[model samples]
Target: MEKTLKRLSSIRTESDILREFLAEFLGTLTFVCIGCSANAVMLQMPELSLINGPLSWGLALSVSIYVSGGVSGGHLNPAVSLGLASIGKLQWKKLLHYFLGQYLGAFVGSLLAYAIYNQTIDRMPNDITWPIFGTKSASHINAGSAFLDQIISTMFFLMIICSLTDEDNPMKPSKGLLPFAIGFINFGSMIASFSYNCGGALNPARDLMPRIMTAIFGWKSAPFAYNDYNYFWIPIVACHLGGILGCWIYRLMIGNHWK
Candidate 1:
């Protein structure tokens, strides 16, 4: 325990921060690439169900966690980062670096996915393009409900993540199992978001950055056109709020017991 704390605390050097940023960037890139590419392919196919996107995202994120868990704790999602920081697994001072790396990485990943399937997109009509990249609230669901949907989804996700990574938790899984557990529940979370039509975007970087890419590259109104409200803010803002709440809940329910 002492050695682990020492090593974690020792990462205060400039080079270390830069390395951590790069790891986060690359990890997020890997996650968004595989996850969103799968969504794009499925969206273009038309015959497939929406469930496929969540499956792909969950599996892709599992791989992302495996790839980057060692260096940066595999915080491919901003909500995950916020949860970790809230619980003291991450330092608050370096959050800006992590957020920047994650957003940039997500942007690049969205561009890469677009490039890979741009041929089909260019030939396709504009109407179908938005659903491929950005998410929306279901027509029947109001914007407020959609906002709550995101909060609940991210809140559950972060709590599970905190529990899995908590060293003091008896129910915590081994390192190898952590990714799968997170991935599996992430799949569940996406299914939960289906009713709201937010596509279970528990991560701001995952939702907003790609939405930005779509908006800039001709899909100007796609990201915010859902319902009577601009649905873009729901995932980005609500997820952060939910993430903080989740960690606090975990600390209250389980983490504090160690003391």
Candidate 2:
């Protein structure tokens, strides 16, 4: 018992905790900014095309996780953090801090995206151009379809995350594979989902901050139609529910060994 206690205590320290928080903040910020900014740039380029948007996002997330996984477990998405918590991989006490960090990071990232694209936005022929790459609109589906898409996509995303990170997976040789697996998953999911109907933002933080940024910038210039701003809640609530469902489903299939 004494040896076990020592092992537990030795795993982390207060400084480690502080560093994790900072890493989470900066890593998430970098991811959203770079990914969204790339999308914005693509929108201005007639040669780029919409098909490349999702791929760009996938690559951005993959690179960010590769760089940040060592420090904060690479939880740039609030849904991912919540899912991990439900699976007992993350402490409940730190949930609020992680959520706050991710949200703030995303907000800052959006600001950066806006800043970088300000010139392009100003020169755009219309506000509709902004929604082409951002998360504020769903050109591919209607409201009902958008909600459903978010739910299903988030479910799959969380399941993949839980499975890849699972230690019991005999297939998983080492942690080195995690970033690549996660990146590929994101890339595949985006290609499958993102289109005219919303940008397939499987992440609540990714969706919310950009919407908030659009609102702050004024609806006239905002990309989304905003017929019902409350509609945004669907992604927020559904994503969390999807995360919980993913954790439960993984447990059902693989057993509760994750605990």
Candidate 3:
């Protein structure tokens, strides 16, 4: 009994919690930096076609998950965390800690992207490059359209995530494929909607942190900064809602036998 008690106490130490929290922070920071930095570089590369954006983001996200999944569960997105919590897959006590870590990690990642691209950004004329970094403007989209696009894209993304991670599904084959599945979903969503609306940023971390970085870097001079940027919270909120809805839909359709 004493040995068992010692083992349990060792698992619950402050150091263990801190290590997990730091892992979450670093994992999320790396994900955002790689994914969004790729986007920024793609925008600045005159030789490269804009057509490669979706594939680039998908590759980055996939690689990040493969590298970080063991330590942090690879939940680099707030919506993913919320979805897991809603389904009782995550501990409620850790929710806020995870969220704070994700947000701070993303902010750091965006700042790094800004630094890496600072020279290229300065060289480009404001007219040609501002829109690429900034959020979609009201002039670029209506509130209704933006909201619907976010909801639909997030729903699809969440469904794919839940399905891939569902262990009980005999058809799922193995956990080895989850990273590829997630990457493909991101790729599909970006290809299907990024051109029509910039807010198709299905990952809230991908959108909000970059926007915050943009503001900090004085990209607020960019068109639609104040007008459209104010609507940024909608996508964040909608994505969470869509994730919850997607989980419910998955349970209904797939039948949650795979507890």
Which number leads on lDDT?
Answer: 1
Runs off by more than 4 Å, candidate 1: 1-14, 189-196
Per-candidate TM-score against the hidden true structure? 0.89, 0.84, 0.83
Off by over 4 Å in 3: 1-16, 46-50, 125-134, 137-140, 189-195, 221-230, 257-259
**Window of ten residues with lowest summed lDDT in model 2:** 132-141
| Candidate 2: residue pairs that collide | 138-198, 139-196, 139-197, 140-196, 140-197, 141-197
lDDT of 1 by residue, 60-150 (tens): 8888889888888889888878877887878998798899889998999888988898888878776567656666676677778888888
lDDT of 2 at 243: 77
| Clash pairs detected, candidate 1 | none
Scored against the true structure, residue 148 in model 1 reaches a CA lDDT of 87
lDDT string for model 3 (4-112, tens) is: 9999878754564565567667877777777667666777674553556777667667776776677667777788888888888777777777787777878787778
Single out the weakest 10-residue window by summed lDDT for candidate 3.
Answer: 221-230
lDDT, candidates in the order shown: 0.81, 0.73, 0.69
Best by the TM-score measure: 1
Ranking by lDDT: 1, 2, 3
lDDT of 1: 0.81
